[model samples]
Target: MAIESEVLVIGGGLAGITSALAAADAGADTRLVSYKQSTLRNASGLVDVLGYTPGGDGPVVDPFDAIPSLPDAHPYRTVGVDTVRDAMAFFDTHAPRYQGHHTDANALVPTHGGTVKPTARYPASAAAGLASDDRDTLLVGFETLPDFNADHAAAHLESAGVPFDVHGVTVPFPGDLRAGAKVTRYAGLLDANPRVSVD
Candidate 1:
């Protein structure tokens, strides 16, 4: 048996998925093939347009403004800034769950490692936690997840001079899972039972 498609995307990673979706949206019969799990499954779910430049001293403030500064050999420069902007707009139109700052500027989002990253777009769920927001914020960490230390992250954010008041607390997740369980297991459980209260 054989399958037919007008557009054949060869991978399942972010780029491939985006290509396939774009092709399908353009009225093409697209088919995507992958040999392994998608890299998106392990990603932080942030759409980072440009975090840094090759020899830049700090994170980029505006990805569009910085595009001209990129080296000639860089992919962004090679494709031209207009193409990058069009790609981002295309992504925004298709991905309703993710959003950008609605401008050429980047949003600063805090990571689990106590560092803030500049991104053009992020998951809508993280909108309230942007470092630019001056509201009081609380970070809750799970005891089973050793990689993320909420208290330490809070302190680091304070030291980094974020414009918001932030605090952290560690608590055990409400489940019978072992301490050694992978983060995916916990995420799967939460997905399976959205009403699983911590209290």
Candidate 2:
């Protein structure tokens, strides 16, 4: 048996979902097929445009600036930097309607493992956690949540020479709800109400 759609997006990863949505919004009958629920559930929910300069050392600051330096085979190199910029623009405009927006530059954000990595765009919620030498920060963790480690993240960020004052505190989830789970589980809240808040 076979199904039909103007665009058939295989895999349910971030890229695939975005592609399917874009195609649908453009008036195409798009369909998505995924082997699992979501490829992003375990993800840090960060958007990384470019992490490195091909095989070069260090991370990229302005991804657009580094585009010309990319190899021909790279996705950005093939589609052209303009495409990336346009996509970013799309996210920037539409993201607010879904509780997110495209960040201007790469940011150092923590992961579920309490490690930090550079990413180009991030949700407004996680954007504030970027490693900054200039901004003072207070890191907090939930006692019930085993996924996030405040101490580990603080140590890692401090060792990286984040200039801002850093501190950690523990918080509790409401009522008997100890899930303290990843935000991805509540993704529907965005669709249900843009103004919805997540803790």
Candidate 3:
């Protein structure tokens, strides 16, 4: 079979997906191709614009402000700040679950590794967990999943000088899945049983 597309985007990662979507939105026949699973499959789903500069002086407070200072050879510099802003706006319009574009400042999001990352856009569900929000937060980790240690994450957040009181708790998951199960397996189980509760 022969396939024809006005815009053929290679790969299925975030950049490719965004390009394909943009083309489609512009009334073009777009096609996306990927050899393997999407890289987003293992991603945290956060849209990071610029986290830090090459100097590694500190986290970026505003991606737009920092982008100009990036090295000339950097992708952001080559694309220009306005193009980056447009790309983020396009992402915001397509991804309704993500909340961003209201401000130029970056939001500090707590990661599973207990480290806080600065991102321009993030899932709406994680709004409460932003380090800028000065509310007591509780991080819950699964006892079966050894990759994330909630208590350790909380301690790390505190040590990093977060503006909120954070605590961690390890709880048993209400399922028969083994401790060594992959994240996809856990996600599948949860999708199959949304009401699964720990007694």
What are the lDDT scores of the predictions, listed in order?
0.87, 0.70, 0.87
Per-residue CA lDDT of model 3 for 1-199, tens digit only, reads 9554598899999879988998899888988999889969889989988888888856889889988888999999999999998888888889988986789998999898778999999999888789888999888888888778999999999998998888999999878868977777777888899898854
Model 2 regions more than 4 Å off = 1-5, 97-104, 112-114, 177-199
Candidate 1, residues 57-106, lDDT tens digits: the string is: 55888888888988899999999889999999888888889878477888
For model 1 the local lDDT of residue 60 reads 86
Global local distance difference test of model 1: 0.87
Q: How close is candidate 1 to the true structure, as a TM-score?
A: 0.89
lDDT of 2 by residue, 31-112 (tens): 8999968858767666677877778755777788888888888889899888988897776665663222344567777665
Model 1 residue runs over 4 Å out of place are 1-5
Clashing residue pairs found in predicted model 3: none
Question: Backbone clashes per model, in order?
Answer: 0, 1, 0
Candidate 1 steric clashes = 0
Instruction: Output the worst ten-in-a-row residue range by lDDT, candidate 3.
Output: 1-10
| lDDT of candidate 3 at residue 160, scale 0 to 100 | 88
**Candidate 3: TM-score?**
0.89
Superposition error at 77 for model 1 (Å): 1.3
